[model samples]
Target: MAAIVPVPVVDDLTSPGAQQSRPGLRASQSRRLNAFRYLVFALAAVFFGLPMFALFRMSLLGSRPGTYSFAAWKQIGTYPGLLGSIELSLEISVITFVLMILLLLPTMMWTRLRVPRFGRTLEFLCLLPLAIPAIVLVVGWAPEYNRIERFNLSGIMLIWAYVILVLPYTYRALSAGLNAIDVPTLSEAARSLGASWATVMTRIIAPNMWQAILNAALLSMSLTLGEFTVAYILGYNTFSVKLVSISRNSNNPVVVFAASAAGLLFTFLLLLILSYVGRRRRRRRA
Candidate 1:
């Protein structure tokens, strides 16, 4: 009233021009967000992918000047203990996975159905391994392993040791899968229909949690395949140990790179096959 100053209206705040500009502004923002996401993905790819690319390139380079050859790969078969180490590693991984499924799956399922209160305690026990260093674990096991060696095969002991290492991860995976499905309800229904405990577990629970089981198995295998410390410290000749020895002994980088590339490629293919199989089963179930 004093100055007769104009006051802004709400309508003026969202005028037709402003309304028209909003869609364009939103579209510009959306494009920018998409571009930023793509840039991040590209950067991430370059960050992780460049090293692998370089390793592959180095793997292809021949030991001699002005020459390129796959002698490194060819020589893998001739490495005295390599094939054995690979076989042994595969054996360990398979045995560990089987034992895990047989032991962990059933026990976890039972606990989920019967002793819900103890679930937290069980989880705590499983996670204790993560708190203990591998060196400490190996050191603790050394005396016991030496005693067992007198009577039982060390391979058996190795599998047991690996089980301890892989248990926490395997249990978590299975627990997640169990949680996703109504295991209690399923068990009740099965039991009402006169399904035995074994039948209920094998047919009902196992079929439903197939993906989780496979995931856990894959993780265990991957760990076993790449494990160097446990095997080395325990004086076992596994694939990783052999690879390390090769790297240390051979001056040529080609052999080391070739072996590494082979292992990486093989693991990729294995996972790819497993993924395809899992998808196929899912489609069938659907």
Candidate 2:
């Protein structure tokens, strides 16, 4: 008689601790936080979601000016450059996402995996914008954004500003992703396996934190999309500016409400997808 058993192949990249600490909230914390967290989330739901709800209602019912109809959304679809503006804004956000990954990937590996000095300094540099007043940033960039001599006064300025403003949040999301992975062990093993630094980073590191990357990218995209002050200051009137302008016009109030509702709905859907991704990542690890 013989018994058959499957043999598991071990990759040197996995630390014993890696499987032990897959980043979903621990059960004890979940038990403690479930009610409190749900309460907090409910309050946040009321706070952020209510205004958008009002906007939707305003679009549909306010003024009885027939403004509450889906007509506004239809009209928005017909506007010249409207779709282009949305596409262009997305391009900028995606660019920012790529640039951030370029900057973050190595820095995180160096800090957590390679144990490099000055990593904290760079991290601090990335986080510096957190303290800068939005108004001040707008003021600082106002003149530069509209430069005639530099030949750079265009959509790029908008992209750069959104990217800059969103850097802190993006960095934290990605760095937390890094913290959740077995950076040192995986990287060292990859090195041992004759994988180059680039391969190790692109393959080993990124795939591990796909959820975090999604979260960061989505967060950056939403932030950039909704950013108002920078667009106003930069004179780069994209969707947000146009929305603001529409809101300002008493006659187009319905259009404003429709736009706000569409925007909120889109953001919430994107966040839901991100949450699903995080949950999936945890399940796969388990």
Candidate 3:
């Protein structure tokens, strides 16, 4: 009678046999890490998606007899002032975004090139907005906005106010992009090649910092679209103000739910597209 016995293979650290197992061990570790990453991603998706699902369900609520429906969603068009509010929000967002780029890009580049020391001062001023509450800023501008009404300009003040609100974010984005490149060197090279300051900024500097520019513009647009306090205090019927007004007056959650869901969807898509484009640009550069 014979019994079969197992023997362990002890790998010596300096042995070629041990080196052969290294690849297998590393591969196993990689697989485990990837599995953990996927698990975390799935959990995060659920964490963020659950509320959106609940909101969507609410948007479709009261549509039928114990049946889920989207009648409320369709009624978004019928909602009073809904379309006008959306249009005003879009107008402010677009105008503010344009002003952010035009007003900031040149000044940022000029500061970096002409007076490097003032760069910190500029950044400090930009961060000041974060320190001041939006309500306080709105209150301070109340008198000026009142005067704006005398001129019949109305909500146009919102565009300028939004530029101030969006400064902190857009400045940081532009500063990060500027810090990545040598501004003085780029400017000198462009000038030596017969480029005007305008040409240098528009063609040379802007192209290099396109990502920052895009980020700033999109961030400005996002902020403008979601703005409320200033618009409300100043008596402008921007989208967010209208949403709150409707929710307060109608006491119907459906319109609120529908608008929120639509806004969330739009924001998500905008961010997703930006992320994809940035990744593709990085890949192309690499």
1-286 per-residue lDDT for model 1 (tens digits): 0111122111122234734344655787877877897999999999999988987777777767767777878766777788788889899999999997898888788888778898898888877777776677899888878888889765546888888888777777677778879998999999999999889999999999887888788768877777777788878888888888878886764667877888888888886777677677766877
lDDT of 2 by residue, 202-237 (tens): 899989987677767776777777777776766666
Q: How high is the lDDT of residue 248 in model 2? A: 72
TM-scores of all candidate predictions against the true structure: 0.84, 0.76, 0.84
Backbone clash tally (model 3): 0
- The C-alpha stretches of model 3 lying farther than 4 A from their native spots are 1-43
What ranking of all candidate models by TM-score puts the best one first? 1, 3, 2
Instruction: List CA RMSD, all candidates.
Output: 14.1, 11.0, 13.5
lDDT of 3 by residue, 30-56 (tens): 778778979999999999999999989
Candidate 2 vs candidate 3: the TM-score winner is: 3
Model 3 TM-score is 0.84
Positional deviation of residue 235's Cα in model 3 after best superposition, in angstroms: 1.7
TM-score of 2: 0.76
Each prediction's number of clashing residue pairs? 0, 2, 0
- Arrange candidates, best lDDT first: 3, 1, 2
lDDT of 3 at 11: 12
lDDT of 2 at 174: 78
Scored by lDDT, the top model is 3
